[model samples]
Target: MSLRIDNQTCYFDTDTLHERLPANTVTVITDSDKPMSAVEVAGQRIHITEAQAGALTVAGATAGRRYLRATDGDSVI
Candidate 1:
């Protein structure tokens, strides 16, 4: 899965989920080593299927941008 933030809108894309976040909100990406069963953004949680965890990239405004990803048992980036 991948997440992108543009201005006040956030686009979250994955094989099973695609969502647009509200404007001017803080999103806290959870940090967990276990394969993701769900994702939280803007205080909303969306469940996901079991799969190999992927990388995360967050870039945009300073105050509203944040990202977290689960380490694949090796390292956390």
Candidate 2:
């Protein structure tokens, strides 16, 4: 599945999400099953799952944060 939330420059997949970030914004997309494990390499698009997006939102992630971290969570519906 895929999603676009709040007009944030990002895309969500089943286990990963890709993003076209704005200037100066850095995102850390960690492996949901493995805590502290960052899966994205530098100079690459941000990856996040839909469930992860919700988790990030619940964990206080916003559109304008300079640094954002998200993890894969269970799907919603």
Best by lDDT: 1
TM-score, predicted candidate 1 vs. hidden true structure: 0.38
lDDT for each of the candidates?
A: 0.46, 0.42
Clashing pairs in 2: 17-47, 17-48
> How close is each model in CA RMSD to the real structure?
7.9, 13.6
Lowest summed lDDT across 10 adjacent residues in model 1 is found at 52-61
| Runs off by more than 4 Å, candidate 2 | 1-44, 63-77
Error of 2 at 36 (Å): 22
- Off by more than 4 A, model 1: 23-26, 29-77
lDDT by residue (tens digit), candidate 1, 1-77: 66555665667776766778653343333334443444575445644333311212233222312255644687765
| Tens digits of lDDT, candidate 2, 32-66 | 45433222423444445446545445444543323
Number of clashing residue pairs in every model? 0, 2
lDDT of 1 at 77: 57
Give the clashing residue pairs of candidate 1, or none: none
CA error at residue 34 for candidate 2, angstroms: 25
Deviation from native of the Cα of residue 39 in model 1, angstroms: 4.8
